[model samples]
Target: MTERATTSQPTPFATRQLHPAGSADVPWWRDAVIYQIYPRSWADADGDGIGDLPGITSRLEHLRDLGVDAVWLSPFYRSPQRDAGYDVSDHRDVDPLFGTLADADALIARAHELALRIIVDIVPNHSSSDHPWFQEALAAAPGSPERDRYMFRDGLGEDGSLPPTDWLANFGGGAWTRVTEPDGTPGQWYLHLFDPSQPDFNWDNSEVRADFETTLRFWLDRGVDGFRVDVAHGLVKDPTFPNFGKHPGGLMEVTHEAPYWDQDGVHEIYRSWRTLLDSYGVPERIMCAEAWVAPADRLARYVREDEYHQAFNFDFLETPWQAQPLRAVIERSLASNDSVGAPATWVLSNHDVLRHASRFGLPVGAPRPNGIGADDPQPDAELGLRRARAATTLMLALPGGAYVYQGEELGLPEHTSLPAEARQDPTFARTGGLELGRDGCRVPIPWTKGGASLGFNDTGAAWLPQPTSYADLAVDEQTGVEGSTLELYRALLTIRRERRLGLAALAEVEGLGDDVLGYLATGPDGRQTLVVANLSSTPIALPEGAQVLVASGELVDGQVPADTCVWAQVD
Candidate 1:
């Protein structure tokens, strides 16, 4: 078996099949834990109420303690802030609000010093409407070469008055937007799946493809390890743009289906990208996709050996906290990715969704109808911390790459409210207020409990309000506490890195009870770890012949008493 050097000293033996002695070492991404940091909300320095590169640099020690192998920062490019930096107005330069290019360089250097690789978000499928390229297309004459950069078609009706297609925008509006010609003549329309402010680039156009390649090269040259591509599956759409016929249920399909959604040509595009990435001398650099589609099998295509390294496995996010349903989703995800020789990435919450505490039927502050109310009895802080540890143990023991959303280590709960005026997400406004706003999960990080604004900043106000209860959960407050959730994460991460337990192969996963979930991970070295989680309030008996290593709740006779989980080394 082969061995790779790690910064930490080795301790316990964990089963891992070291690659063949002379074979090329597997990429660092495999079995690595990546922490996602949303730049705007992580930490605010300079009293700007916005997190910047400097702020992130100041917090490297916190991330280092978390034991993550890498950090993935959300976009920090020049933008109009239409989509919170997702709409890139300039790909080469860092947004002044976030910091300068020099600041980014400092961030990279600092992160590496902490033994953490840095990956940035890249949006190749579209650009902000305010981007120069879009402006150029607007200025160029209709049917001109520049106009072809995006899909531009004339009206399709008999009277030349109707839209070219009935495609609905993913953000709930007409996908096509009309633009008038310079001479006041009826001009062409364009396609935008997200917002009208974000126009989709036509991959059919060679010029558009070349421009994106240049963008990729720019970042690779800048020393960014890799990218998390946004809306990757939406890059290539059906060329025919066929309208779906009426459904048997007599309802018009509001959303586009995946079969026609992720066009076959996308494979060629990703293959080309893989070639470019290889040419950069950074072949193992990570490339993950944010793909939302049904039937996990179809989504596996995005990560075929020559395509992306990994794509978001959202089955866990959509599953209820119940053990049976969660088990089914996890098994399906494992089976689906195994077929394609691709690794899966698991995440339960992100900047785009409600926090797990609320999603899992736990009381937020009080009791309401959704299993736990704001006023309903609150679970003890210790109980919450135990559950958080149990969840992490289960996630880390799973046979795949794990993604931890920012601030989850503290067991942070979702914010209850954000004034209507503070809501910046277009989805909330576009849906006519029907959707629960994502602003709740996007609250600012709590830096310290003793300071104003939870030490996130000394400024007037954070972009979003800090959660009221975060003071007790701040990093400073939990770092020294033995059983704190933050410390538990550090321990898990240390084990993953030192013993390399993350590289273990899944031996068996059974005992999926109504409220209990269990699995075993074993390496070729005869080391094994058993992970059992009590997902519900009721306690469950632990399996026999297990040496308890780490646990949540009380332990009795080598088993977790109840309402807790135990991570043990099987004898």
Candidate 2:
């Protein structure tokens, strides 16, 4: 426990008002560079071998020095760790592994003191089955009000033995799991879009709706600036459930067409939430949706004026390192958000995906699996790191907000060869080795070069083992090294803020090869920041009369080399 000390009103940490290309005034969030802190792997204080609130508080200076306007913390609420804290059993409090309620209050106060706005993860699509509401649903009768909080339906078999639907969990296995009645007879089934320990909440229930509102206010009152709404499009399912009737559904959101995702009804909920956020007024709170819909236009709906403030631009992240497709995704994402009067947000990696460095190095023609297991072919480390740095330059040069995952600045690659015994992701456990799990990306980040846990904790212990390779990429090792990814990122952020480049209007520039990507970010004062990326093997000519601000690699005379990106100031 700790004191939540009040501090003098801090400088604008979250956002700064800006108008680009004659557009509406944009809030600070639109131009902010937000760092995503995965608490479990960030920094372990208290020698518990797990990252906690105090650890994050101690590291606030790292974020401030990195020039991030805000920090988006992944879920750390009380849970069974079924989905690595996404399956919240208690949304109002912190889990003991992370810290206490007083610790959270102190963390928020510290963030404010360091001039960093806080955006916390809010999982509304589901709750841990161990949650009180779900527990009550299990003990109550079929028609009881307790059952209404979650998706519960009667089985169709003669003895009601079969599942209510054939839908499969996103993590694998049947979506519906049946429970036994109090008297030991067969019982109804409950839906879990994820792991069995996580039950999908019924958004149709008024109580469920009101309960999330309470959770939102609880964090906002504690001084959190906003929220990253998890699975934002997966709420408000189709009432007909038509897709599930004739067949057992096992479709992934490969096309974003799943019945459980992107329903029109979800918009109303966000609109109501926007209203709630508006009432808070000062320091202007915001909400971002982790919606995984295809087509930029559809994703734009989540950020409409009356709905959420921003939605993660994931299409760009999944796009291959090809210039044409990458350019298209960036253009489409910005255009779509512009249509909604909202700015787009860019991200290269997160807790769930392969690090871009490794992902970029995979064989261009090989299969792109979610997780790369031990037996998978090793990526071209040199090539991948080069492209990753180039990609980072392109990402930061584009208009709108950006998210930097923990350790990304250090150029930390995913530890793809983790021993099976060290894996803890529920997907890995449930799939029974059929699919490699996200444990690779979730490995605790290395802070220092030496120590059993890479200086993550005082006692050198960790939930996930750090690879020997991590020593070279540890924060301490990369911090001041010239041409290091960490230094590259710091320079990028400094330039981004000093030039207001994040709020610049992006437009295509001519004269680059088809395999090259070129765009100009026009500042409000008419100066331009031109970004040219050479995705091609051959060199590409840079714009004449431009002054280079920074580049991912050394330039050869006036040409941008293959797998290199440059930011230049132009008239």
Candidate 3:
């Protein structure tokens, strides 16, 4: 993809008008550090070997003490669990696996009491194949309104033999799936960008749009602070259903001209949602787009003034562990988001990819496979943890918001040796085990050191088995341990909030080599904090007279060690 030409003149930080901490005038999402909770793997309150809302409610104190401003929960809606709740059968109610609607209500109320905001995931690009609407579409005739709500079209060849287009599914194989008619005849094909169990919605249909609005209101009335819109960029597709000539990667990759993603029509949908959110008025409900678009400028469109309030910086997440590329992504991200008057959201890892800790431990240019197996070359645990801490320290020092995926604070590594039969991700099945899929990263996290399932559930069972190494990294093991990863995270977060770093504006530091990343974050009060990351093989001297605040690793005679990051106060 081509990079957008950036103007040399930087916008004045003062003109950005970032809201002060605790100010009710602006929305809380801006500059907030949000934590992502993969609910099904977070905790199990009912002893059913799966996490539920009550389990999440019991864990709120952990997040509150961790210093995050908000928590973004992945989908726990009524679903068939075909794509881990992404295939939603009912948007209005919680699935029994995750507790009842009353459980959801109590969770929201409890979070509010702790001064924590809640942002639920909303999968609007598609619905579960078993949804009532999709069921109706299946039962209805080809030309019926029920079928119009989804992307249903006649097949290409005679007797409906071929799919209409060659667009590939994000998971694998063809994106189109043929159906059997009520009369037992071969029928038209339906589009599903991911799994066959998920049918893509026809966003052009008025009924679909109206229905999503009602779902939005239903949650807003239930006291949710906002939503994290999944597949935000893929909602509105090119009407022609043009073929994507070459499949780039297994994941939905960065393609500037892909007909199915980053369509301009998506802005209109988000703009409407923005209006709905603003209408609430009191706590300022907001939406963050989980768009994987590219070129920085195009990605910024999702967060334009009248559109989404924030968008994930996947470009940053994918950047290799090199200072030069990391700085480039940071600068471009800040520039693009600044152009649109939005804060750049930084994230290292999530439920989808290999954990950053493991990724950083691999060779500098090694590929980041979705899953790691016993046969795969393992990551260097010591090296990975060191770099992970440094990367997070550098990320937290940057301007704007940040996101921490579940178990990241404990420095959890991916469960590389999960048996094949235990894998549940659709990608693994679709790819015929060639790709191990994301199940490795989504394993249940450890809460206590000794348990049958690492304290994930009361029954000593877990939906996904935990790695034995997790016992050492459990919350109970690291809670009050000095120099532990968990304590390091707490300290970093405390410093980040006290310094108001998230509300500051950053400027690149001159004279830093290609092996080092150096920037100064200047707060509204003119207090400057210097953040420097040494990705080089050797030690780097700290700037003269900079008061050291925190370092990812111990300083070696007043110098930042290799694979280390330091945050300091400077005049």
Candidate 4:
């Protein structure tokens, strides 16, 4: 058999076949750091106290300076402002409150010019009840195809006394909404996983699936790089509508059927959308899922090559400020995703959660009666800054991509309290005001020190109150400081780009300490970088023989003193 033409070395063709070019080169998504901007609170150009597309466009340079490769803008689609714009009445046009469609186009153009890709949020899981399609369904004859677009049925018993199934809405109400048909029937019901105003689309219906595909194409045609799919796991629901059984408190538990909601068949839907996006000929376009599920293995499925490019790994966001738990989550995430053929994406906070500084103990202020207060004193602020920088350092040192929530770079803490009437989050209302509303985290970004609403806008009160102390933390104020969080972020981002970290490589994490975390990033070229973070309240000694490339605090002889992080070139 001539030994299959075996030579001293394998032929190039054989090697190529063994490791394809597509497998070798990193996806544009892997090494990129995505900055998430909540449009309603990012910046306001019109003095309306609401951030608009033009406002975002004007701030492009600031984002560029931050060293982010892309920006993920939260939904600005036309809506009635229910659920903070997640209820979309139209997917194709920009909301008039945010700006005109022309403004969106201009923002995209300018973003691309700055070499930053823009990804918009797409809410395919549901639409505002005010949407034309929903209105038509509401008036359609019972059992008509239009009504089938949503989950609708007659009341439970012949007497129409109960819902078909007992399921709780995420917003703390019955998931099933009673609706009177055009004929004035008293027992009709519709399924809405969230607010009644946001009806869940029936993905089982082929028409609904096709409509989403069209929606994806709509944005791709309009020059959007990709989508941050809202409630990606909520698209599919159990056809059986099984009851989740009561909670221990007997509050009529309803989320038990969640597993069925994120069915594997949903991949077929995502694949179809991916196919359309691929046809658009955009390079490095990405799709990320806002999935909240268990079994890291199951979450990994959403980011497989055939599904979304990435899924937000929210474990860190929920993890408390403890070293052991944090390390375990990171390790498990790396292991699970590596085995499942998907890259992990890390985030400390987002529009829905409390800011990192507050969550992680960065000085914001005393916890006021309404949850408002300055962080701790300067020492506490410095300690918090150290932790924030360390968190990012650890995130970047990991094997996959990392996400930076807007305003996080400034060590921004959550602002929980608002006047009783100004609070708009449903979480608070539904929980009988027990839940700390998310409005604080949603405050407008402070751009300049005490300069006209922190330069967010030239208007009255912002949609959410601007933090009174923002004057000190404004970007203009911190930009000049040598050891500011902003500067640390810039340095890390530059290092990420210059190093060309691939998504597939497993990081060798080690050197764990009681008040510090450390790891090493190893690339295909055998290059290695050492990362160390001080998780303590005071300064600590740094490792030897490592050249300091980036440090969150002052560097001393290639060492990072306490409450700091340093990225050192190992080889």
Candidate 3 total steric clashes: 0
- What are the lDDT figures for the candidates, one per model? 0.72, 0.83, 0.87, 0.72
Off by over 4 Å in 4: 1-24, 245-260, 362-383, 502-506, 509-515, 536-540, 554-563
Best by lDDT: 3
Q: Using alpha carbons, what is the TM-score of model 2? A: 0.94
Candidate 2 achieves a global lDDT of 0.83
Deviation of model 4 at 487, angstroms: 1.4
Per-candidate TM-scores read 0.87, 0.94, 0.95, 0.88
lDDT of 4 by residue, 453-514 (tens): 88888765588876576678889888968877777777778877676553323333334456
Give me the candidate number with maximum TM-score.
3
Question: For model 4, how many clashes?
Answer: 9
Q: Give lDDT tens digits, candidate 1, residues 161-269.
A: 6777777766666777888777876778888877888888888899989888898888787777888888777788777776553321111122136323566677899
Choose 1 or 2, whichever is better by lDDT: 2
lDDT of 2 by residue, 507-569 (tens): 666457688887777665556677889999998777567789999988887788999999997
Model 1 CA deviation exceeding 4 Å by range: 1-25, 244-260, 362-389, 509-515, 552-558, 561-563
